[model samples]
Target: MPVWQTIYSELSQYNFSVFSIMEDKNIEDARPWIEKSGAKFPCTIDTNHIISDLYNMFNVPTVVWIDENGKIVRPNDVVVMNEGGAKLVKVDPETYIEKIRRWVINNDPPMNSNDDFIKYKQQREHTDNEQVARAEFLIGQWLYNNGELELATQHFETATELSPADVMIQRGTMSMRGMDPMKDYGPIAGNIIKKGLRLYRPIRD
Candidate 1:
C-alpha cells in the first residue's frame, strides 16, 4: 500500500485517496505499525489473504496499482520508496527524493521489464518451491523472534530444502551459521551438485 500511502500523503495537491490495505492472513499482527503509518488514511483488514497471495506477496509491504476495471497498470514492485530518491548506484538522500518525485509523477515506469526481471517474476509463480521457502522463512522468523535459536535452524533447513537458491533463505541460513567457516561452504558444494544434476539429468528423470 505504499502507493496509496504516498497518494494520501499528498492528497491535498493530488486528490488521490487510499481505498484499502487488503492485508489478509497473519498480517493481523502488524496492525500497530499500520495504524501508526496510516493515521490519516482508511485501513481495513483481510483475513483470507486472497488479494495479497494472488499477487504472490509472500511477505509484507506488497502492492498493486489497478485501473478502474481492475487491470494492473503496474504489478509488483510498483511502489517507489518515499526515501527521497537516492542515486541508484551512489544515491544520497537528495537524489533519492528526486527519484521518488519522478516516480510519483511519471505515468510510465522508469524502465521496461527486462528479460531477467520477467524471468524472476515468473520464478515466483512457476515454483512451488518458492512458496515453500516463504513458509520456511516465516516460521524461522517466528522462531528467531521467540529466542529459539536451535529450533529456528530446523525451519531454515526446511527453507533450504524448499528453495536452495532463494537468497533470503540463504542469508538466514548464513546468519545462523555465523563464525563457523567450515559450515559456511558446505551448502555451496550441495548447490553445485544440485545444479549439475539438474543440467545432466533428463527433464523426465
Candidate 2:
C-alpha cells in the first residue's frame, strides 16, 4: 500500500491512474483502512467478490494492466511494492519498478507478452466445480452480511473445500471469523504450504 502511494505520488504528474479494490471487505469495513492509508486514488470494495470472479483473482494485491483500448496487457501478478515490502518475498523492488516503467513507456510490447496470462484466462473459464464454489462463496458473503455467522461459516467452508486453490474464498472466510487475512501467520499458509502450493500463483497468459 505504501508502495502504491509512492507510485501514485510519483506518477500523478503523468497520464497515469491508479485505483484499488478491496476484495472481501464491505465499504464500511474498508473506509477506515482507506482513510488511514491516505490514498488519493479512488478505492472500491468487493463485498460480493464480483470483481474477483471477473478478473480471476485468487489472492490479494494482484495487479492487472489494461491498455487504452481496454485490453489487458498484463494479467494478475503479485506486485512487489517497496524494498521493505519485497523483503517478505525476496523480490527486488527496483527490478519490478523498472518493469513497470518499461510497460508504461513501451505500452506493453508485443515481444514481452507473457504466456501465463493466456493460460490463466483459459483456466478461469469456469468449470462446474468453480461455478458451485462461486455460488457458495456468494451465499456465504450474503449470510455474513445478514449476521448469520454459523450459516455463513458453513457456506464459506463449502466454498473453500470446493475451490481449494482460491485464496479469496479461504481468506474471505477467515476475515469473517475475525482473522487478519493478509498479515496473520495462520493455518491457511500452513495448509497451502503442506499441499506444495505457491502462495502467489502467477496468472498464466
Candidate 3:
C-alpha cells in the first residue's frame, strides 16, 4: 500500500496510518520495512484483532473507509480516490490536490454514487472467522519459536481452515505433514527444530 502512496494518499494529500492486527501477537518480522519506509506515521498494534474482526479483514492488505459520524459510509475498496464525489477518473497530481482542497473547504464527504458504492461493497471480502484464524496463526508462530511444536500444530492447522491459501498457515500445516514429532523431537531436538523448519516453506522460499 505504501508503495502506491505517490499516486494514492500522498498525491491526494490525506493522512495515512497502518494497524497490524494480532491477538497480542508479536510481529518483529515487519521491523525492517517499518524502519526503511521512514513513513513517520504511527503504526498501531491491535492485540485483540478488534478492528479486523469487526471490519471483516481476511487479507493482510485491506482498506476500510469511515465517515465523520464514525459510520462506515463506504466499507471496502476505499482506494478509489479518483472519484470526484461521483465520477471516477484518472486525475493528475494537481487535479487531485485541488479536489482535496475543495472537499476540505466544503466540509463535504468523499462522495461515491450508488453504482460505485455497490462495486466497492462487492470487493470487501472476509469476516470475523478469518480474523480468528489470523490470531491463531500468530499464536502458532509464537509456539513454534518457543519449541512448542505440538501445541503450535493445533492452532496452525485450524488457521488453514479459515484461509486455506494463506502461505504462512499452509507452511505450518505442511511442516508436520509426514513427521512423527514425538519420535523426532524426543531423540533429536536440534535436528527436529531445523528439519521441521525445512518442512514449512518460507515466503522467501
Candidate 4:
C-alpha cells in the first residue's frame, strides 16, 4: 500500500490513473486495511473473484498497466515501490518505478517488447485443470457467502488441489477461516520462493 501511495503521490502530474482491487474473501474484512492506507485513488472490492478468473491472478499485489489506448501495456506483475515491500521478495522497488515513469513518457517504450511481458500473458492461458479449479473456486466463494462452511471448504479444497499453482484459491480458503495464508500455507510459500517465480510477476526491462 505504501508503494501504491507513493505512486499516487509522485505521479499525479502524469495523465495516468491509479486504482486498486481488493480481492479478498470478504469486502468488510479488506475495508479496514484500505482505509488505513489512506489511498487517494479509487479502490473496489472484488467479491466474486471474477477479476482473478479473467486475469489468472494467483497472488496479491499484482498490477496490470493499461495505456491511454485502452490496450494492456503490461500484464499483471508486482509493483512494489519501497524497501519495506521489497524486503521479503528482495526486489528493487526503484527499478519498477523508473519503468512506470518511462512508460508514462513514452507510451510504446522498448520495455513492452521484452519477452517477460509475452510470458506473463502466456502464463495466464489456463489448462484444463486450471479451468476446472477456477469454477470450483467461484462456487466455493458463493457457498461461503451463503453460510455453508463445510460445503465451501470442500469446494475450495478441490480448487486448490486442481490448481496447485494458483495461490489465490489457497489464500481465499485460508482467509475464509481468518488465517494468514502466506504465513500458514507451507507448500504455497515454499513453491513461490524455491522456484524463482515472481512473487508478483511484473514485467522488468
Candidate 5:
C-alpha cells in the first residue's frame, strides 16, 4: 500500500489518482494498513467483497484501469504492488508499474487495439455460476453478520464450490470459518495450482 501511495503521489500531478479497495471481512482488519500507508488517494474496505463481485475479480491487488471518461482501459488484472508481493505472486512488479506509468504519462491504453481489448473482455466475462456465487456470498455474509455461523458457512461453502477459482470467495470466508487466511493461503493456492488454474492472470501488453 505504501508503494501504491508513492505511485499515487507521483502520478496525481498528471491527473492520475488511485481508488484502492482492501478485501477484508471487516474494516478493523484493514484499518492498520490503511493508516500505515498514509495514502492520500481514496482507500476503502470491501467488507462484503462488493468490488470483487462488480469487477469479476478473484484475486487480491487486482487492477482495473479506467480513463478520465470512466471507460475501462484495462479490465481486472493482477498487479502485485511491491517486490515482496512480486516474489509471492511470481510477477514482476516493475513491469506492472511501467505499464501504469506508460498509461498515465502517455495516455496509452494497455492493449494494442480495441479488437484485443474486446476479445480479452469477452474471454474474461463473468460466468453464470460466478454471478450465482456472488449472490451466495452476499447471503453468507449477511448470515455471518447476524450470528448464524453454521448457516453462513454452508452458503460460503456453496459459493466456493460454484466459483472454485475465486479467491475472494474462497479465502475471503476463512475468518468466518475460524481460519487465518494469511497462514492458510498455501493450501488453497496449491489446490488451485493442482487444478491447472492460475491465480494471477494479467492483461498481455
Candidate 6:
C-alpha cells in the first residue's frame, strides 16, 4: 500500500491516479491498513466485491490500467509493488512497474496489443459456474446485510464451492462469518493447491 502511495506520488503528474479497493466485507477489517498506509490516492472498501465482479478479478493486488477516457487498457493483471509482496506472489514487481512507467510517461501501451494479450483477457472472462457463484455471493451479502446469518453462510459456502478459485468470494467473506481469513485461508489454499489450482496467476507481458 505504501509502495502504491509512492507510485501514485510519482505518476499522478502524468494524470495517472491509483484507485485502491479492499474486497473486505467489513470496513473495519480494511480500515487499520488504510489508515496505516496514509495513502493520498482514492481508496474505497467493496463489501459486495463489486469491482471484482465487474472486472472478473479473482485475487488481491490486481492492477487494471485505465486510460484517461475511462477505458480499461489492461485488465486483471497481478502486480505486487514491494519486495515482500513480490516474494510471496513469486512475481517480479520491478518489471511490472517499468511497464506502468512506460505506459504513463511515454504513453506506450503496457504490452503489445497482439493476439496473446487479447487471448489473455478472453481467458479471464468468468465461467458459467463462476458467474453463478457471483450471484450466490451477492445473495449471501444481501442476506448478511438483512441479518440472516445462517442463510448468508449457506449461500457463501455454496458460492465458494461453485468457484473455489475465486478468493474474492471465499476469503473476502470469511470475516463476516466470524472466521479468521489468515488462519482459515490456509486450509482452503492447501486444497486449491492439491487440486492443481492457482490462487494467483500472473499474466506476464
Q: Tell me, by TM-score, which candidate is best.
A: 5
Off by over 4 Å in 6: none
How many steric overlaps are in each model, in order?
A: 8, 8, 0, 3, 0, 0
- Listed in order, each prediction's TM-score against the native is 0.44, 0.84, 0.48, 0.85, 0.94, 0.92
* Model 4 TM-score relative to the real fold: 0.85
lDDT value, residue 84 of candidate 4: 76
**Considering every candidate listed, which one attains the maximal lDDT?**
5
How far off is residue 19 in model 4, in Å?
1.7
Model 1, 1-205: lDDT tens digits are 4445654576425433455554422355447757666546767775433443356553333444454455654455422244532222122434433443454465434224545445545655636776776677667767766778788788878877776554334543455545242467556546745665220110010
Segments of candidate 2 deviating more than 4 angstroms: 82-85, 88-90, 108-111, 114-120, 123-125, 178-185, 203-205
Candidate 5: tens digits of C-alpha lDDT, residues 88-146: 66768788788789889997777679998888888888899999999999999999999
CA lDDT of every candidate:
0.50, 0.73, 0.48, 0.75, 0.86, 0.85
**lDDT (tens digit, per residue) of candidate 3 on 72-187:** 64453222233451142232435434544444446454544656565656754665666678788778767776888888878877886675544334432344444443453333
- Measured over all alpha carbons after superposition, the RMSD of each candidate to the real structure, in angstroms, is 9.6, 2.8, 12.1, 2.7, 1.4, 1.6
Q: Could you give candidate 4's per-residue lDDT for residues 145-201 as a string of tens digits? A: 899888988998898778776777777678775667768877666776576654455
**Considering lDDT, which of the candidate structures 4 and 6 is the better prediction for this target?**
6
Q: Candidate 6, after superposition: displacement of residue 143 in Å?
A: 2.1
Worst 10 residues of 1 by lDDT: 196-205
lDDT of 2 by residue, 50-160 (tens): 887787677776888777688877777665665665675565667666666666765555224466556666755766776788899898888988999889889888887
**Candidate 3 structure lDDT:** 0.48
Clashing pairs in 5: none
Give residue 189's lDDT in candidate 5 (0 to 100). 88
TM-score for model 3?
0.48
Cα TM-score of candidate 5:
0.94
